[model samples]
Target: MSRQVKGVVSMRKGAPVELRTVVVPDPGPGEVTVDVKACGVCHTDFHYREGGINDDFPFLLGHEAAGVVAEVGPGVSNVAPGDYVVLNWRAVCGLCRACRRGRPWYCFDTANATQKMTLEDGTELSPALGIGAFLETTLVAAGQCTKVDPAAPPEVAGLLGCGVMAGLGAATNTGEVGRGDSVAVIGCGGVGGAAIAGARLAGAARIIAVDLDDRKLELATTLGATHTVNSGRTDAVTAIQELTGGFGADVVIDAVGRPETWKQAFYARDLAGTVVLVGVPTPEMTLEIPLLDVFGRGGKLKSSWYGDCLPERDFPMLIDLYLQGRLPLETFVSEKIALTDVEAAFEAMKRGDVLRSVVML
Candidate 1:
């Protein structure tokens, strides 16, 4: 049977989202229907509203979410009804070449629910990042539901579904930040702040946070940033180099996703150190760095796709750490709002007012 539930939807470009009846179908083979408990309002959701992501109007606009499995279809054994899980967009297909190479994080064939969710009029809605989570109930691939410690609050745990996971994974998985290492993160928003926390978790001796916003830089301190630099008032690369005894940091992460920030990340790292770009850039944005400089850097320049994360492996472990107080995942939840307030949350996000304004379903 199909279920009708309320969901926040972007009906048109540059317009406010509408709360409308969403027709959610019963799970099919390899699918699961989730009772969403909480979902975070992220910048990506706003991008979709502005037609920045694509012309996929009427998009179900939430992805960072945590919920319980309300039902599972045939052939779905990884998760069961009543299991608490963090929803991930990356549902790795085991038969992919990346999976065959034992690198499932880079799996080329990620999966989504075979069936589509629709409006009351039968218009198909594109779920944000393939996990439309703003609704009361959502259908997704069974593999997208990664079971975690149920003790963690859904508001805090859901963040791992996207931004937080991206930042932390950028440091731990892509940047390889390790014990006694010097790490620098540019952009002190949710993702950058998580990178700072991840660096702390990885035991980085000195973690420098660079951002244009003083407020965000201040928040970065609480997230384990050893030093903060207001990039607006100072040169980020010079400050990072000076902070690391004029040698530059071992790892520099550009969480802002702008060309200027990427260049700063490149120049702010020491010779042979890693530069990780975890930020999302628009299609038209281009880089014009000299080839000579790229050769002279003699280090790794990499783009972090979803933080190179494997949900099944990382989500459970991260939830456990959060429960143990080793990871302060709760700090990322700046405020909690009802689903109706998601439109306002987008404005707050634009003004840099909150790290994450989660919607409690």
Candidate 2:
């Protein structure tokens, strides 16, 4: 049987999302239906609204979410009904070449629901990141639901589905920040702040946060930043070098996804220090850096796709840490709004008023 539920939809480009009846079909083979509990309003959702992701009109926005499995279809066994789970976009296929090489995080084949969710009028909806979570109930691939500690609040746990995980992975996994190392994260927003927290978790002795906004810089301190630099008022690279004993940081993370920020991250690192770019850039954006400088750096320059994270391996462990109070995942939830307020939350995000405004369904 099909189910009709209220969902936030981007009907057209640059138009406000509409709350309309979404027709969700029963789960098919390898699929599962989820009862969404909470979802975060991320910038990516806004990008989808603006047709930045694609011209896939009437996109079912919201990907960072937590929920419980309501039903599972044939061949689904990783999760069951009534199980608490964090929704993840990366549902890695074990047979992929990356998985065959023992690196499932870079799996080329991820899964999504074979059937599409649509409007009452039968218009197919393009789910955001293959997990349309702003609705009361959503259908997704069974592998997309990763079982986690149910004790963690959905509002906090859902954040791991995207931005938070990206930042933490940027520092811990991609950048390989180590004990007593000096680290600098450019852009003190949600993702950058998480990188600071991750650096702290990794035992970084000095963590410098560089951002244009003073409020975000201040927030970074609570997230474990040892120093703050207002990039708008100062040269970020120079300040980072000055703070790191004139040697530059051991790890520099570019979370802003801008050419200028990338350059700063490149120059702000010590020789052979890792530079991790976790921020997403637009298609037309380009960088013009000298090949000689790239060669002289002599360190890893890498792009972090979804923070190089494997949801099944990382989500449960992260949730356990959150419950233990070691990881302050709750700090990322700046506000909790009703599902109807997602559009307003987008405005707040645009104005830099909150780290995250989650929608409680």
Candidate 3:
């Protein structure tokens, strides 16, 4: 049977989203209905509302979420009703060339539900990242749900679904940051801080966090940064290089996704050190580096998409670390908010007042 679920919707571009009743059809052959318990208000959500991602107006926003599997369609073997799960964007298609090459993380194709949750008038609503969870319940492809430790709190677990996970994966997975390595992260937002924490968890000897805000620097310290550099007052590359004996860090992640910061990350790393780009940059921006420098920089220049995460493989392992206190996932939750409070949370994020504002549905 179909159900009427309340969800936050973006009716048009650059307009305030509204809470409305969305009709969710029963789980199809390979879909599940999640009773979303909590979701985080990510910058991506705001971007979607601003029509930054695409012209999918009437989008069902909010993706960072944890929930209970309320129902599953037939042939669902991985999850069942009542399983606590963290929703992930990548539902790998085993047939993709990347998967065939044994790199499932780079799977060229992923899957979401074949069905669509539509508006009251039956107009199809595009879901942000194909897993909208800002409402009481959301429907998605069963594969998009990754079951994690049941004991984990919604606020903390939900973060693993998106930004937090992305940062962690960028360091540990994409950059291949290793033990006793010196790592520098630009932009101490939720994603950057997660990279710091992930670097620590991966046994990095020194983790340097670079940001423009003091508050964010303090939070980065709490997340396991060995040092903090407020770039607003200093040359970031020189500062990072000085911190690392003028050789720069072993790995530098550009989480701010701007040309200036990416350049900093480029110049602030040791020879052949990895430079990981996890920040989302807009089309209006273009970067140009000296050809000689680009040729002389004998290192990996990589971009991290969703941290190159394999949700089914990474989420549970992270939840285990979070539960054991080896990972400080809880620190990412700056505040717990209600659905209606998302707008305010965005404001808080803009002022650098909070690390993350999780919407407890």
Candidate 4:
């Protein structure tokens, strides 16, 4: 049966989001309908509205979400009705080239809901990250709904669906942080702080948090950063080097994604050490580095797309860790807001007032 759901919609580029009732078609094949309990406002949502990600409009914004699986389509066996699950953007296709190579985490072709949700006017809505959840419910590929420990709050587990997971994956998965390794993460926001926490969880010897704001830096310390660098006051590259015994950290994560921060991350790592670019930069900005430096640096320079994560592999494991009291994933939430407060929350984010403003339905 078809369903109607109330969702937040961006009618046009650079315009305010409108809350309206949308028509959600019943899942067709390999899809599931999720009764979204909580969704987080992410920068990607803003980017979609600003036309940075694509020109697809009007968009159904909001992706980071957790919910109860209310229905599943034919051929779906990963989840069942009434399962408490986290909604993930990436639904790995086991047959993708990346998957064929045995690295499912790099799955090249992901899946989404086969049925389209549309506005009242019958205009098709492009879901933000393909799992729009700033609504009563949303539809996604069944594989995107990963069943985790049902005891965890939807608000907390939902965050692991996006930014939080990206940050943690940047450190633990892409960066491959290990015991006795020294790491530095630039931009102490939600994703960056998660990298710090992941570094600690992986038993990194030193974790350096870099940011202009002292408040965020303080939060980084709470997230297991061993040292803090106020980049606004001091040279970030120099600070990282000094903190890591003058050789620079083994891994330097650029969570800010600006050309400036990317450069800082490049030089803030030791020779042959990795520099993980988890931050998203605007298209207008360009990165420039000397060819000699590229050759001289024997290590890898890679970009992390959703932390190169495969939802099926990581989501449940992380939730179990979170439930065990080992991972303080909940610390990333700054405030819980209603759906209507998303606009104001975006303003607060622009002013650097909060880490994340989650919409608790």
Question: What is the per-residue lDDT of model 4 for residues 16-130, given as tens digits with 9 covering 90 to 100?
Answer: 8888889988887898999999998888888888888889899999999999999989999988999999998888898988889998888788888878899878999999998
Q: Model 2 — TM-score against the truth?
A: 0.99
Residue 24 error, candidate 2, Å = 0.5
- TM-score between candidate 1 and the true structure: 0.99
Worst-scoring 10-residue span by lDDT in model 1: 278-287
Model 2 / residue 312 / CA error / Å: 1.1
Error of 4 at 37 (Å): 0.4
Taking the tens digit of each residue's C-alpha lDDT, what string does model 1 give over 273-331?
99999988876799999999999989999989888999999999999999989999888
After superposition, candidate 1 runs with Cα above 4 Å error: none
lDDT score for candidate 1 against the true structure? 0.95
Model 3 steric clash total: 0
| Residue ranges of candidate 4 with Cα displaced over 4 Å | none
Could you tell me every candidate's TM-score relative to the true structure? 0.99, 0.99, 0.98, 0.98
Total backbone collisions for each predicted model: 0, 0, 0, 0
List candidate 2 segments past 4 Å from native: none
Candidate 3 lDDT over 1-361, as tens digits, reads: 8899888888998877888899899999999999999999998998888888888789998999999999999889889999999999999989988999999899888989889998889989899999988889899998899999989999999999899989999999999999999999999999999999999999999999999999999999999999999999999999999999989999999999999999999999999889999989876789999988877979899999999999988999999998888998889888998888877777898888888999998
Which candidate wins on lDDT? 1
* Worst window of 10 by summed lDDT in candidate 2: 276-285
